[model samples]
Target chain A: MTSMDFLLLTKGPLFQIAIAIFALGMLVRLVEIFALGRPHNYAAARGGQLIPGLKTVYKRFNPDPGTFKRAPFDVIVGIIWHIGFVVALLLFIPHIELIKSMFGVTWPGLPNPVVDAVTAITLFALLATLIHRLTHPVKKFLSTPEDYLIWTVTFLPVLTGYLAYHRLINPYPLALGLHILAAEIFLIVLPFTKLTHIFTAFVARWYNGAIFGRKGVQS
Target chain B: MTEFSLERGLNALREEMDAPVASFFSSCVHCGLCATACPFYVETGDPKYTPIHKLEPMRLLWEQEYTLWGKLKSKLGLGKQVTDEMLEEWEPLLYDSCSMCGRCSMVCPVGNDIHYMIRKAREGMVASGHAPEGLIAASVRAVNTGSPMGLQWKTLDVQIKHVETATDLEVPIDKQGADYLVLLSSMEIINFPEYLEAITKIFDHAGVSWTLSQQCFEATNAGIQIGSKDIAATLVQRVVDAAESLGVKNVISPECGHAYTAIRWEGPNAIKRAYPFKVFHIIEVLDQLRAAGRIKTEGKEMDRLSMHDPCNLARKSGVIQQQRSLMDLVADNFVDLEEHGKFQWCCGAGGGVSSNERAEELKMAAFKRKKAQIEQVEPERMVTMCATCRTQLEEGLEEFNMDIPVVGLTEMIADHLVERDKPDDAAAKAGG
Candidate 1:
């Protein structure tokens, strides 16, 4: 088979399989949250009604929204970091083309240089957070193998893609090919690790604000 | 005032936390979202004043003495030891700034329980003897003399005499078998007499048999505020013993925020079990009485009623619903503050702010959030469920030079009672 034919057959099938894996992983994650949030009858009474179920969430719920909201900076930084991350993820041409091919759709495109630069900056910014996690003594307890691995795995494709785009190596095709593979793996891994936080953060925050507001917690 | 000795004492206290509960304290992510909910953070605009930052001393101690990685950091001077000099920073940051209101913990995404975290930090401060001398003196008085103000029995009698003169209603005293044993904090008897008078006015109007005990009255519990659990429990034990000895069926907590917490929540736990007698915050009592149509009140003329829930009775306790229930009776226009419940802003006086003289500026600054919230109402009066809140808000409004009256939840209830006859002034105004 010609190189293009091999690329079409091998990369195309691998990508589809990777897509299925991503969907399944997401399903498992949603199931886990659904199980946790099934609304057990026991979580009804709150410690204080003024904050509207806030007391109960503290006493009864496993992770209270009120408790986590204390560090607004971490929340704000985490959000800015994640928004840039998702936009970078969707705009990468190979992944976007792959997604379009699977779904039989297309969206307007970004210039190659612009997309690569964004991918490099965002992934590096996330990499900096990872390095800070490993080094900061205060953050040491919060650090886990998963924390390091997830960010490293997330950055791999961006790193490889940046290397390919920058024309740093002789075999640009090989680097780009490896980058495509890593992107496939990362796309599949999104729902399984800390990335689940991306989907959960909004649901958690808005749900909390609404519930507490109605209970007349927020005047 | 900052003390040199307190500096050393604070270091000693930090050492204790390092030895025992450092694991619990060091665990936090500094997300600034909690600042939006914190009155202290709002007033100071200092990230360190936010609830998450309140744990920094403890976090520093944890790093220096515990966790292998922290121990490594300590060796490199990256992690500063909790030395005598550090107390200079920790004292005002922890005591003056924090109200122990638990609002940050309420909003925390990780369920950090910043209240307990702050309390643990305070435990370090308390053990170091870094707490306000007045609080220590008063709590010691409470331990030895059975009250915080250290009032003599004769003075207690004089106050009862005053209550008689004001209401023409007798408070059951040292009498066994009364239907209710009404508890007052030292603030009510020693500072504000009208709160006790309000209780009497309601009891007279409702015909409930209530009595004051010369043996056990004042309910202020500094132990809880300062994070000394033992002293907190002792504060509760006094009320439990008095009620048990007097054979009272119900224990009514005065409007003091910390006092209500000591009695209603920690009091039962302090007694090594729950008491058979029901614990009712004054607002809860008024609410039930109003709902049953047992008490009559003359509603205030103000159209807009903004009720601020004291953290103790509202966020700290679950009786915030009663604030609204009572508010429903007080005015035609009731605007709920959005950041109101467990989310409600503290009057900055709830966690022993009234007694900490050094905390006066912090208290006033903390009250700025509540004051701002009320200013939005453009109301005739602001109603609150705590005596300390009334005190804090009243003084806070004056400090900011705003002309709003701060009244108690019970006072509002009494005003809105149906049995209240329209004043003669109403008739004169009608004729005019």
Candidate 2:
């Protein structure tokens, strides 16, 4: 067949395989969540009361209520790190482009300069996190091959997408194809590995906060 | 209930489960930061005994099973070695050794609860008949009879009567429809009646519609400490049912740390259902009265009061901050001990070790740790939120032989009972 038809065949098979793998990963995660249920025996956490006074958590967590104020750095970093990661995962231009191509829907795009700046921040965070995993003894000890695999998978898509944008690799289609493959692989792995932490962590934090919150305590 | 030759059986269980727990164990990176948070580690200066170190065998297993290189190393028997002897040695090193304070989790960068891991290990060992004779017996007594002391019904009757006589306040026996049902740890009634006296005075001073049921009164649930979840559930259910029968709006837990945690945190699981009534630690109730103007303080004198954090309450149950804040409300001398809140040091008496045969040695080491903490601030009294801590601290303090009082929040509240100084002669004569 012609070069265009060859490219067309490649896209169809890759997309099909990616979707199948993503579905399998999601199925495995469901088994783990329900089958390996933890002991959620927190009673005070389950009820809500119209408490008139200060909450129990503030009394227990900080003791001194005045010490509860957040530092500006905490507010800024906590917001920036959480929001930036979420948006990058959902709205990163190239990833969004892949979504549009797969589903035949599209959205407005970011300016090129803004895209460049955000991609840099994502890469910077990836590198810093990798360094922490390697250097911090606790993280290093607790981490496994799956952990490193998740990290490697994250870096690949961003690196390839950035190269594809600048045409740094000369051939645009080859680079773009590999970038899509990387994104697909990352998605399949996301729900299976410690990458699933994104869901479990909020569950843990909110549960902890809610328990103390019901008692009129800061969680 | 499960019995075995303490030393040998412990080894065998540790042997059969060596690969699993030891392999799962490599998750901790001992930075010695956990030491500052653990009373035993801080007092003994022993790295091997820190809460994280208790997971060393499990870490050995984690290395063998989960990691790429560690699995490769295990092929040649090169990963952290696990043996029956190693498991045998870890009995004291893991169970009798650590208090399961949960403070280590607060300082852990990952919030890894090494103490929970230790307790889980002990449970596996206990299932295989590895638990100490003393602990096993107590667990047996609790499951069979309702108290750790194995107090007979007749004996509890005498104790209840004495409590009523001493405090001149009615300590209800199996009463129904009380506004509050006060649950006491067997430890308080059997070992320290002075605590009962204090609790009675608070009930009387506040004029709260409350009662104490002789049945279902043992607040100490050894099931929790021994990791026997079913037994803990059974023990907690009795009290839950009693409170429901009393129809109280709240069930006030005495100054026992694990008791508060068991009833408040594990109550739902224990009963397999929820009770509508609230469960409050005695400190929580006292704090409420002080805030509501039910009980007024005269001097606010204890403002410089330095408090010791009981492990089960502070870290596991998450009441240390509330206990401290309530103390701040009552005293002007509320000097916060440095390691306060989730970051505070353990009382070193929890995890069923309070009644252990080795309790004296463990209590001594734990006291040394707490004494140094107390000396830093040197407050007038070391206030506590748990009855077990009060007992252990009092037990530990005899070594120092200092005159500093060890008072529970309830006892402190009893001291501040401000009932509008009645015109002495007139009030005495009226007797209204």
Locate the minimum summed-lDDT window of 10 residues in model 1 chain B.
B18-27
CAPRI-style quality class for the chain A–B interface of candidate 2: incorrect
What's the DockQ of model 2? 0.08
- Candidate 2 C-alpha lDDT tens digits along B270-301: 66777788888887777677678677655565
Per-residue accuracy of model 2 over A74-149 as CA lDDT, tens digit each: 2233334445555665566766797797788877666666776677776776776677667654445545676788
Question: In every candidate, what fraction of the native interface contacts is reproduced?
Answer: 0.04, 0.07
Which segments of model 1 are wrong by more than 4 Å? A1-77, A80-219, B1-27, B63-78, B297-303, B416-432
TM-score of each candidate structure, all chains considered together: 0.69, 0.69
lDDT of 1 by residue, B153-197 (tens): 677788878867655556678778888888887666665676776
Minimal lDDT window, size 10, model 2 chain B: B18-27
Scanning candidate 1 chain A in windows of ten residues, the lowest lDDT window is A38-47
Find the candidate with the highest lDDT and give its number. 1
Cα lDDT of candidate 2 equals 0.63
lDDT of 2 at B385: 71
Give the range where candidate 2 chain A is weakest over 10 consecutive residues by summed lDDT. Answer: A61-70
True contacts kept of 1: 0.04
